[model samples]
Target: MARFLITVVPALGHINPTMPIAEELKRRGHDIAYASGSDMQQYIENQGFRFFTAGFPSFKHYTSYALRKMFEYQGLVSNAFFFKVLIEYNRKLIVDLPPVIQAYKPDVLLVDCITHGGAQLAEVLNLPWATSHPIPGLIPSRDATPFTSWGLPPSQNPAVRACYRIIRLGQGLFYRMFDPAFNSIRASLNLPPLRHCVVTNTLSPYLILIPTCEGFEYARSDWPPQAHLIGPAPWGKVSAQDDECAWIDALPHDRQIIYVTLGTVQVFRSLDFYKTVIAALRDEGYFVVMSIGPVLDKKELEPVPEGFRIEPFVPHAKILPRCAAVIHHGGQGIAQDCIYHGLPSLVVPISQDLYEIATRCVSAGVSLKIPYPRLTPQRLRDALRKVLTDQSIRAATNSLQARFRATNAGATGATLLEQLARTKQPVYRPGSAS
Candidate 1:
């Protein structure tokens, strides 16, 4: 059996998506050991793989509710959070990562792109590593540009367009500075320079496993010979007991049901934002099933009207099929799930690569996006109304659903991982010899 070491940044976004691939490798008779924080021990071990704990300061003290609201209120770029994350990851790399590398001496290393130090560690050990991105962005190819790049075209609104250009320029500078650092790390270790496919998450070309019928990606160029759009990885299925969302179950059969959740990461931070949504939908006579996450106290918030419902958590997969539409933060996991149900969406993007996903959804004519800070009852009302009432949006979402269903997303991605492991030679670690 091939021995593989998978190192993820420990962020739920990155770690969760890679789990399916790791599990699939195990089923194929490969030996797998994944490295991440201590908290994920249950999740990783439950899948029956060996877990190696790594100390990543950035992920330390994570609060599911606080982080979720932070996204709704500030998004990923709030303050110097990204830079702070970068420093902490680098600090851990210098101290804790080397020993893990020495111990595992893996044949191949799989890392998440945002985990800067893991990439560097791969270089120091001269191991072949593949990077995974939870959201679109990172690759600079032309086809992927409109969807992933921060680069913007001049728009009719001169002021807005100028702001867009400034952001694009900054985007170029950010990558330009980092590319050299990655190359330097590789150079010092005598490994070949980073390639688009290895560093970016393009494992194959032509969207192989993504189940083209359910969802769609914008055209991309500079695809690797093997790069594909593999569909979403696995998710933990909530049990029947956990699926008790009373608000949803109690809704009258005559009222249209709408489910809104920003997810566990950033749902709590946007309390004021959610209040607006709640108020807008209250009088509209719809059955609003909202997952506030941890941001607000159930008792402290204003009393819900007879038709309204609130909960800290809800089974999204179960509720999506019963709802007329969904409203959410534009995180990929939620986006993928919403698409899977073929429900039209109103996406409010706060930060990070979410803006891109929202933009892509709008372009595809399946959803509408409202800036988080600018959210109002009217905006929420209008967005929800559009998605719920517009024939075109509903049609597009259904069409996308059909597209996604046509492919074997999980199985195809597993096949690619297995094939890559078989063909690629394990990088040699000098002191790792038995």
Candidate 2:
């Protein structure tokens, strides 16, 4: 049995997808250990994996800084500050990983794509590592628009293609902001400067495991040979206590259920959005089940509307199957859950790869994307109505659900990691090719 070490940023979105893979590995008689923030220690240990705190600040600190800066700053300044903080966070993880590796002596390292430090450390140590993308692959390609371009719809129109090219050029300029600090960190680790953009450079050329399938994603021919398209590896908690989920059972059975969440990161800034949703659906004959995330107090949303139920958290695995539709921040985890459960979605993407995923969902015909800036109560209500009544969206969701279910992503990921452990081959030498 091979020993595996999984490292991720502290966020639930990054950590959750790894659970199913880790469980499958353990089931196959492999030992698994997780290195992350201290806040996740209980959650990791609860899954029966050994947990090692990666010596980073609590999740609260990271989220607080992100939330404050995301609202406080604007344009290039906000973007620069976000990357600078992210790089510094990754630096801490890089410093903390050696000791964890020495203690765990893992045969292979599974690093989250966002955790650049872990990815770099894996290379520095010459360990077999596989980069795990909980979201869509960010690798640049000619087959599709750059991920940063909000994943604009692919087309044969020359004008559109030219615009995409211009966007790519602009994206390259934006990436240069991080070049000094990114290269400086690599230099400190005795690694060469990165040739690819920062996002793609973090990928392991040996294996890039994405928890999505071709049916739900844009076709891409330019992906590296090492890239693997495994289906959604979904993992979630379901409370055993009936009382914990009794609220779900009590919802009015006459109305269709709509599951709403802005995801953990965006939830802090979503109060206004939530209020708007509540107002939109106040008498729309739909039952809305909204998860506000634990960071926000439910009391903040005073005078809760009728036909709605709000909670700090709810198990999507248990509730999504019964829902008629999903309205969310286009987070990969929740987006995959919607696909897995065959639910059409209204996606309001705020930041990061969300816009990309939202774009893909729209292209796939299983969702409607409403850019956050354009999201008004009427727009949200209209989008939700379309998702619910559109037969094409339902059919597309059904098609993709079949595809997602056909592939056992957890098993596929486990098998690949095991193979890498056995073969001990490094597919791409770091910095050899951009």
The candidate that achieves the highest TM-score relative to the unseen native structure: 2
Question: Pick by lDDT: which candidate is best?
Answer: 2
Q: Tell me each candidate's TM-score.
A: 0.76, 0.92
Per residue, candidate 1 scores C-alpha lDDT tens digits across 52-129 of: 877552243554343333343343234224434444454465466678778877766666656656666765665566
- Give all candidates' CA lDDT scores: 0.62, 0.80
Lowest-lDDT window of 10 residues in candidate 1? 204-213
Q: What does each candidate score in C-alpha RMSD? A: 6.8, 3.2
lDDT of 2 by residue, 1-434 (tens): 99999998887788888888899999999999999988778767866789988846454567546546754444455556667666877779878889999999999999998788888888899998998987555677775766663546768788888888887777778877688888888999998888543776578877888888887777876667677788888886443432477677667777899989987667546788888888888889888899997577888787888778898777787788779999998888898889998999999887656777888888888899988878888888888888889999999999988999898888988888888999987543233443
> How many residue pairs clash in all the candidates, one count each?
21, 0
